[model samples]
Target: MKMADEGRRGEEDGGPGAVHQVFVVMESLLEKLKVLNYEEEILAKHNMKNLSRHYFVSSPFLAVNPGEQFFLFTVIAAWLINEAGRPFTAPQEHDEPNATVSNILSELRAFGVKVDFPPSKLKSGQESSPNYPAETTEEESVIEDDAELTLSKVEEEMIEEPDDEEENVMDLEALKLRTCPTDTEASSKPEEILEATVDAAEWSLEVERVLPQLKVTVRTDNKSYLDRLQEDVGKTLEKAKERYQQASGGVTERTRVLAEISEELEKVKQEMEEKGSSMSDGAPVVKIKQSLTKLKQEIIQMDVRIGVVEHTLLQAKLKEKSNMTRDMNATNLPEPATGPFA
Candidate 1:
């Protein structure tokens, strides 16, 4: 968290250059210290803390480099891991074969280092001892009912086994339909478990060092951006209105044309019916049927046009809604009435 603290300070004070130098040095040190993952948490142990401090004082060779601060941090990280008696593969510039997490854990075990997840503090079951007490009868009934439902569902699925390869493919396709969290969610969980907070000073320094490469300037003038966003939203709103009107007109025209075609088809059918009745001929009936079929096809074509126009209008409405949301957010910002930039 020292890193995060330093970062925040750099932001508040505007002395980003100095903080960046410190962060780079610390990061370099961390890089040198092997086993920087969950194993780094072991540094709280007594042996590791002393060894870590000693290594920093003794390493005079890293005093003069452009990345000297980073170099120190790497050494510190290494000393902490060493003191904890955790096995860390000394960092190498080039990749090495046969180095794995299992291998390192085994090595640490040999050194008598305790390497495992921390003990959980979760309470026991419903019929609790010191923690949770027994549940009420109603609650117990609900739990039992839910358990039965779950068991039945599972049994049903198991009974319906994929006997054929085609069924197996279908099952796999169905499994893919469920939602899964992104990589961010997975990474965030570990930070919480480790109780890690980036020092503000270090964070600010790191951001300053890295942000320039990204070319994403922080929005300092809140009002200016709001004005720009509002202007953009207004334009989008206008465009959306125009598109909606055009779509409405197109749909109306198509609907009108379809109605006229339907009327014509009905009239043709009536004439054919009359001719057939007068002459006892089936030819007129067949001709009228064919004409009606052609008219139906024409109606279908007009319907497709109306459908396309409706889809376009829906998209325009969505765009208008998004623009309106942006406008609303802009209007909600307090006016910058008294400031140097204002």
Candidate 2:
């Protein structure tokens, strides 16, 4: 649990929100890469450019190919995993990003680094898990020892000795010589010491004479330019805010009306789509087409029947005319007698 808490703290400390400290993490990553011999193994082998300190850092100001960054991140991660005695396959350019990130996180967790962030954060190759290199254990200890020794040496050098000028300024030997009595003074000092001649009242009067001259006074200014400027700025800001409000008073109403219009349009569009779908699925059009086809077939049959009836009537008319002619020929003697009588 303690290790987990430490790992979480480490992750939070190195998280993206700490933008100022990202360089520290990047530097650590660069050191780890150097320890892995990336200069000879990765860059030289691939004929790639040297990695910058911010190579894996995501920044809006830095334009980089995300595909290349992700691939490089995967390659380095796989190499590190292999170096840590784990057999891991390096990802390719066309590999799924989520899968690659998951695999890397799995391997990182296998090394006991707790990862709580989502895989999407790693997709840009900006955030990398902390790497613990097995080969650097002894080297790190030795480096730390050397650093401690160097620090101790620096501290020892920082310890300053007393200067001759400071000793002269103190004059401790002179003070001691004046404080200790010599042999001649020790023998004659008891009766020959001088007594005070001046009065205490005179000394106090002289001190009072110079008291006003020794007193100091400081004057304080109440009017500050910064305070005046602040008041002016505040008034200007208030006037600007009032003017802005007046100019854009109808903005909220316009936005609400536009939103309402958009909602109505969306409703109308949905209704049209529903109507179109219903018409396409309905049977009325198909039934109407079938009805029209049946009527056409019935009209064609009626025309055929009318033609047959007309042909039969014409044949009967022709037969009647022929019979009439034959009857006139058979009765030719009666017709000649009538003509003679006429």
Candidate 3:
């Protein structure tokens, strides 16, 4: 019984969340590709397999199976390298006939890979080879060792970890024994843990199911495809520039309109000031008329205010009457010691 419980616990807690992570990686890839205007021909030939091939072949340290979804990150990394207009660093042997140097380059950029170039060389357009081949150095050797050490530590932790005590305290007559509090708690933990484990299992199953259906969505390798995207981008930039010019011209026109409005407002203000000065010369009837207009507005506002106050008062009276009626009707009932028992 203890062994069964321990097995269940191991299955639950030991599960990895790789499915969700893969989905995230796939979704990110689509998002990055959304804005890119790929030529139809180029898009026709593009597949995840070939893309992975391009990636793993380039990076010496990385080896990925072309058919698997798990290598999406690596493919993205490769795509980033190409997009930034860098030379294809993947070994020449892995290069396919259809894979243009730019496809690999553009994919890397699409994935938002940052390649550090010397500013001085960049300004001069002078390309320099990396001192280390594909991100390896002597310190990385030590880091690798450290990684192995950490992994060994984790394995040791996994092996030596103490089992939950309730698992060992199983009733011999499992069917006859009542559900104990400790057993209930232990059972509850397994349900929650099992949920997570089941989710991973379900996701893996889904990936397995869907992977075969993912008919290698071919991507464009044609030079015209990149050219087309570049042309589209150029046209877009031109349109943006034209729109900016038109917007700038519109802003100038708006500024002129605003200035005219300002001048008109000033004229109106000056005219009003002149009329005020004339009125100040003891025009009693004009002042009386203005006072009468203000008085009429005040009277209107007061009427509205009075209406609101009367309505509120009526509502309050109605509520009071209803409450009183309820109180009167509530008599001859059992009275609790507490006041206002409902």
Candidate 4:
């Protein structure tokens, strides 16, 4: 449990740049739990409290019940194992802690993740227990990668058209040869004199022959360009107007709707504030406590009354039995005497 506390301390002391690995694992586990619908599957079914984003994170300052944490850990681990296509018995509250941890670790290893920590570390249900979900996620990712590769191969085989970009690619070696001067051309004899090889008249004639081909004419028609620009602007404006109408119904209508929504929001906020204040006022709690006190007093009074009634019933039965016995003895003696005297 101190692992989470230590991570928080490190984050605080090391500034914003510090991140803890335990938190990362916990966050990943939380996401996996969400995917598994733990809210409905576990919490709601068991009538347990909803888990927090950092429910798995343990800190001494937080009053987290260790038994609850351990139970949640076992439940989530069993669920994740089942999700990973493995058969695992869900752990019960009476299950031995060490055995539960061992089973979870066994499942994690079955998923191909190494367990370096002892089972005791998992006893807290925070440090190492969350690793099971991460292992399942990794295995799923590997499976997805394999599936993707298979799909890619199938797509490649199904492709009927050649790639135009591949066909359009130019020969880099030919281009290099044309652009780069050869070693022989770059090298010159040490004793050779540097001179112009071409005649000026022939060069001038060759330049004139190629110059016409290089002289490009780009005609600019401002009227046509302006017309096209205006058309494009008009189309863009029309699209904007249509989108605006679809999105907002009109500016005035939108403003009125917004005002109504704002008014409703304010009312809701006020109601929420009032409820919050009432809940925090402790009146309900006081009333419940008073009711419990009154019930206890009533229970004590009922117990006294029941005891008195039972005692009175017992005395009355004893007295009636004594009176019947005396009457029986007197009747037997007198009947014998009257018969003899008569």
Candidate 5:
């Protein structure tokens, strides 16, 4: 949610510093991609360069799949910085925010890491009720401690002056007055309750304002990552399918070729045997043996190659079958404002 606002401001401002920062991010990403023999085919498919300018300026990543979008964001962030003519810099270090339960949950969602942050036990409809602040038993305990401190102070003051009987009696009455509710006090209870209710209503309105906007942020973030993954993996899956088919069909053809080679070897062996008994020199037989040996080795090598291809083909299919569900699940935020902090 916090990053969402920064992103918008970066686009609108588009100052030299902002552009430079973005170009640096994109350039850094491209460098990493180069190391991995990565190609920006996703950009080419969209008929656009995966530059930080257009991407940060707009949501072009959404048009692609998750991996592609992720590549664009993570890698392009560095490139944008470079393009803006800024010197390369590493991500700056800073202390993280206080580790509140809410902040932790939000970070998990942002990073697309799943961790269950279970909510505290609450009365039905209590969470949805706005007039009451979302607090746990711990908060109530804190308030109860303040109440006890107030009572202790009153008791000490009473103890400090009790030599005069009338004064002591008056003090007792005052203490009772402080402890017990009179008619006015009882009547004012409704006003206090009303004020509390109004406060809760305001809190509800605040949550309403923040939560939906956060929802939009989360959805867009998830969609961009997903789009890139789908595009990259989806393309690989398709290519794998084609390779699998070709490899599968080629296996039969290769086996037939091997059989033909075997038949030729047998014929050569027979000819060598028939000619061996009458041959003055063994050169013909030796030549036949060498050729047969080479042919047999070639068949063995062919089998190994086929086996490798089959394995590759199997892996591709499994990867293709793997859906984006688990990958996407990490971004699924716990029901808004319902975790421990909420």
Candidate 6:
């Protein structure tokens, strides 16, 4: 029973939470790519063995096979390295048909690699080799150590030796004040220390009494509560992202319509300028004038709609940010919680 409890405690402390940390980090990077609508491409590039599209994003980490997990992690690492303009490159021997900034990219292609964009480097002030490497002197270290040892010995001798009689003499009043406590006072000092001990012992006893209940709570209530909270938060974020995309699409559509209307309105105005005297009573001029007025109204309405959609999108993003922060704070407890199952 004791062994079982200890094992469970061990899992709770650094077991499941630690395993989940990697998944969390992966999700963050994939979420960025997903925002760009390139998640499938990343998966395809890695040529993941059995996992379906967005499996890494949709499913929990435990559902993934260990082999596939390793493959995906390597893929993510390669992508991030490329994204960040990593200085390291594949060894020269591993270069494929081409040897370029993209060489490191091909090295991971067997694993389902995606896009490989080599970043441009600064041309000016580039150097062939570093100018300085720190140098330490053995003689200097030896001298420093010798000096420290000599000082320590001098301090020790000063403390250990009795002072010359004249120097040793002290005022009687100062001596009385400086003297240590008597046996009764000393015994009371131990009691004073033991006062804290008594409190500590009581607290330890209470902890012992409560430990079983606490374990049950960790095994049941806390886990279930956190799981549900995480699920709801995840759902909310997915919905927010969807809504944001919808809002963006609406804005784009409205802008396109507005532009088309503006162009028509411009054409009509130009026609009026060109045919001003000749078309004063013409049917086409009258029609063009009416069309221009309608287009102006439509453009104004579209502009207002676009503005509202944009403001709503901004608020959605801010809300998502705040909710994500809250969820991370609430769910990402210290990674030391012990779990029964690792």
Best model per lDDT: 4
Error of 2 at 167 (Å): 54
Top TM-score: which candidate number?
Answer: 4
Candidate 1 TM-score versus the reference: 0.21
Total clashing pairs for each candidate = 32, 0, 20, 0, 36, 12
Question: How would you encode candidate 6's per-residue C-alpha lDDT over 235-272 as one tens digit per residue?
Answer: 99999999999999999999999999999999999988
Tell me which residue pairs clash in candidate 2: none
RMSD of 5: 50.5
Off by over 4 Å in 6: 1-220, 277-342
What's the C-alpha lDDT at position 80 in model 5? Answer: 29
* Stretch of 10 with least lDDT, candidate 3: 1-10
| Each prediction's whole-model lDDT (CA) | 0.45, 0.61, 0.44, 0.66, 0.45, 0.45
TM-score of each: 0.21, 0.33, 0.23, 0.37, 0.22, 0.18
> Which of 2 and 5 is ahead in TM-score?
2
Error of 5 at 70 (Å): 29
Work out candidate 3's RMSD over C-alphas: 46.2
lDDT of 4 by residue, 1-342 (tens): 222434554566785534455556667666766655678977887788877756666655456777877787677667666755578898887666766666776677655566566666567544444445444643454454445555565456446434653654445455444433245554664666878798675455345434444545566799999999999999999999899877766777879999999999999999999999999998999999999999999999999999999999999999999999999998888443556656
Residue 127 CA error for candidate 3 (Å)? 50
User: Could you tell me which 10 consecutive residues in candidate 1 have the lowest summed lDDT?
Assistant: 119-128
Q: How much is 3 displaced in model 2, in angstroms?
A: 24
* lDDT string, candidate 5, 1-342, tens digits: 001112434567876466344334434434543432234533454454544422322223424343344333323223323322333332211211111223323332333333332211011111221111111111222333445566677577668866654554445455545543246645666544344344664455345334533532222477888999999999999999999999989998999999999999999999988777659678888999999999999999999999999999999888766646656777785766777887
What shift in Å separates residue 278 of candidate 3 from its native position after superposition?
Answer: 1.6
RMSD of 6: 55.6
